[model samples]
Target: MSIATSPLPPTEAKEAAPFRPKAVTDFASAGLNPALIESLVLKYLLGVGVASGRKVAHELGLPFGPFPEFLRGLKAQQIVTYTDAAAANDYHFSLTDAGRARARGYLEECAYVGTAPVPFADYVASVEAQSIATENPKEADLRRAFSDLLISEDMFRMLGPAINSGKGLFLYGYPGNGKTSIAERITRCFGTTVWIPRTILVEGQILKLFDPANHEPIENVRSSLLREDDQDDRWVEIKRPTIVAGGELTMEALEIYYDRDNKICEAPLQMKSNCGTFLIDDFGRQRMAPIELLNRWIVPLEKRYDFLRLPNGKQIRVPFDQLILFSTNLEPKDLVDEAFLRRIPYKINASDPTEAMFRRMIEIFAPKLGFREIDQASVDHLIEHHYRRINRPFRCCQPRDLLLQVKNYCIYNDLPLEMKPEYFDFAAENYFTVL
Candidate 1:
């Protein structure tokens, strides 16, 4: 199906870029009907004993289109009986004995009662509609994304094209540089949020897609200004998700997670990050071997879609529509062979901050910490005495880390927060304890 996705040029970052599913006002537009969703509402009512029809609609994140009628139909069949009309959409309903038995049967099969899930076909259409690779990020967008962080113009130039690729990129550099920080801010470049379903149904199995901990839901204030006649609450608008998986990422996490006991299916990490960025932080430090992890991703990265096996042993294809980032302190060469690396087109070096850039970072950060403006003297003192004498190279995090130490020292000593050579010495001494 031809779904309407916004063609967001890099300059259009300020504009809305969500996959606006049009004309989704009624049960038909939602891609499911009363017959499909009513059972879930019945199961929900059985679980809670009694709830309003509007409350049921709210809980399901579906419209009352044909649903109030569906409930009335249940009442006509003597399966549901309204106890009272407390308020608008506040009619309390309860299931009859037969209804309870049927609800129990549904529960025995699977107990998922929240949000009448969007059909898997709709989800796939939405993903294709808002593919991250389609965004053409301009230099302005990059600047806006990293405006808070002290990024050099050269670094911005390198990052603009790499991030625009939206395929995959290796952010490799020393540990203390801004690889993680850069990865974190990559989502800001798109400056757009997309719609994602909380749950998806496929071949009688329900896979939960939206993760509250990971997906930050954008509050809908502009829906009141839309042309679709109304908003489809089933589709949640979330920030272009930036899912960061660190050293703990396992091979199991890359595939669909089926609960043998609960019989529920949770979407893989890639599924959660559709139309956004997926960062594999501290890349080679994962519990699994680097080769094994790289090999697992070889298909998803290339095909831009993933194949997942359902509980019924049926395989399904899901859109791999995210910019997968691998951030590592390890050198890219030592980690993966050429064949694997070939799939990931862009590899940008998060090189250590230059001395000038390092100083500027301090100047930028010191004031933000409520300290007086840092002077050239403090910068010179750090480079000449602490760095040059100790043979220490500058890292991007040092300025912020050193300031943090100085702030703590000032707090303990009851002194004003300001940058001084002595404070630098104290901070550097403690900060480089391992070195």
Candidate 2:
């Protein structure tokens, strides 16, 4: 069950496509079928390029001998190209363009089934409106921050309609433009429940129902059977699930791996992120290419479900009911073309804050970070000294960082936390760009 084989050829010519079998029974009743198995294998090959046949076999709970035959079948269809290292008795498999298309098609088909609506009766109704008794100070603080920015109500209104339409979002701007902060605020405002796969060993066998094509977790199925009286307190809480992964996500980290003793392969990030928000923060900056990432998600984003295969040749469909938000500082035109951009419906541009908002931010953050006396005179002086004189765009971090530096200076010098010209000079020198 090791996938440490050598590289396979990119493609083979004059090969016929492999036959894709259909399931005889419902996915739940039949457990796994040939089509599901082929789809899962295809996903792994596409995601990881060439993996070890033995490793693939173990993960799928299939006999190791059948894997080479599967690889041969895939190779014959020209979906994958295989290289046999007779010396090592290892066969490496890589997906061709046709293979990739087949895999994507399989995943797209799976996504539809995964996104099937759950029974409404299973959900309990919580208080819709906020009450004085239940009001949280943290929420008030967030509201205050939003109010201070004076963001147009029209801009805010677009969020609901866009999400309701089940379209992806693109948020872009320069650094310090509050894009990340706005994403956090959206999550806080909507409330979010993080959905992680519920894995358990039943009869010494691992069963996962989090497949995007058929997103039926054991918990979801159990919840459906509950009586109304038994489900009074079990309302579906609307909480946004936020997953930030990119710089840390490697090719190996995105696929299934074989475990010999347990005889199982675990689901990857995309599968775990079902029914939640998957935020690709600092998009176009991951180790993988932006096109590669987009290609991986194209099917799921379009269809709202994904099919993932187990190492043992079992394909599982999972629901993809999550808000996907791509936050980047790079220009959209530079990163992706017009054709690709059309797939993402909501494009929110977050620019630098206005001077009034900037000044207010300075006043609010400065005092809290121990700048005890930040009068309007000192604030204006700092702004004029750094931004106007040096011709640098005002950064929100500057105010917050400058306040921290001033506090550290006060503690070191045994002085009160007062905003002086000296502290401003230090802050301006270190944080602001001088012309």
Candidate 3:
């Protein structure tokens, strides 16, 4: 198969020295049971053949306190031995025949051997600690989040309460009018980050939670709510996630996913999006029927909690902890009945820009395209001749699209980047060719 399924390169055999934060000074602090940690340690040794106690802790992404004591016990039991005796607990450790046999048994059952999975209970609890309900974003927060964007006071007023409520809203309007862009920026209001485990354990199965595409890592994070010393490295600190699932969003993707052969499970989309924003971009047009998608959330939307079943048929409750946005170019009334609409109470329209707003967008974007002196007369000329004559509605994206055409026209003619009525004429003729 593909390169992603190929064998991963072996991690370092010897554990490197890593500083421990005060948050996780012991196994209890890491929120893991002793037996679970031991299984991961043995499985890793089975794969690597040798690793130091420090390395084992580091690789497991656990605190060092419990490892030293656990290693001493394994050493006493003749399951493992320190290859070298050093004062710094730097003995390169290797497993004995007995330890390898035990590791083989562990592998036969689950086969998870990388970073240890955080207990599922701990995961649920952490979500509650950082739930979007706990966040109260102010107008200043929204403004700061969307400082560079062209959002009006009316739209901001509508968004402020909806965001503060941390509930679902419909951002319906024409395409390319910044519904997706607005959805993307909703996370910035909370402006705080939370810690999530890389892998969550559910009944001996590994459920990977951290996704690089959705979760951005921060160093020297300056959020007051989640301190580095408040949680172990087992949990990675990320800005509240803004997960956008477009037309490809399926009902299966919204549930617990398991690969029996691989012995791995994937956390449902909502679990990964906890304490963040989950925008169903192009919501009504998803592969699954709009009714089916809305039905799945009926209970979760009201109770603010969801239930997912494990492979073993065990139903587990997880926090439905994100502000859900349904962005669509289609009319909301045409997509869902009144009952569904009521559940999604706030339906805001991101309609076409007014003439003044359109001009402002052109003025703001023109300088970035190397035209510092944007000809006001040329802009007026384009609006009067092109838009008014044709009775065309101005879209927020038109300025960028038409300007690029002007830039290209200048480039092909060996001319400088300047806004002129003649250039707008060329841009409009070429840009509106389809119409």
- All candidates: TM-score: 0.91, 0.57, 0.88
The RMSD (Cα, Å) of candidate 3 is: 10.8
The models' CA-based lDDT, in order, is 0.84, 0.56, 0.83
Clashing pairs in 1: none
Deviating ranges (above 4 Å) for candidate 3? 1-22, 28-31, 85-87, 220-231
Residue 138's C-alpha lDDT in candidate 3?
Answer: 91
Q: Give stretches of model 2 more than 4 Å off.
A: 1-160, 191-197, 200-239, 256-264, 433-435
Report the C-alpha lDDT of model 1 over 375-409, residue by residue, as the tens digit.
Answer: 67887988999888878888998888989999999
lDDT of 3 at 364: 87
lDDT of 2 by residue, 1-435 (tens): 877966554353213232111212222322344565677688666667777776555444333544576678888989888654532476767788999999878655432111111121111011112111122224344455366444545556655455444456888878776677666555444332322222322222343424433232223332332121222111222233445665666655555544654345455665444444567778888888878777777777787766665665765555555567888989877777666687787888776666876877777786567565667777777778877886778665566777777778778989888887777777667665542
Residue 273, model 2, lDDT: 47
- The candidate scoring highest on TM-score is 1
**Alpha-carbon lDDT of model 1:** 0.84
Error of 2 at 55 (Å): 36
- Ranking the candidates on lDDT from highest down gives 1, 3, 2
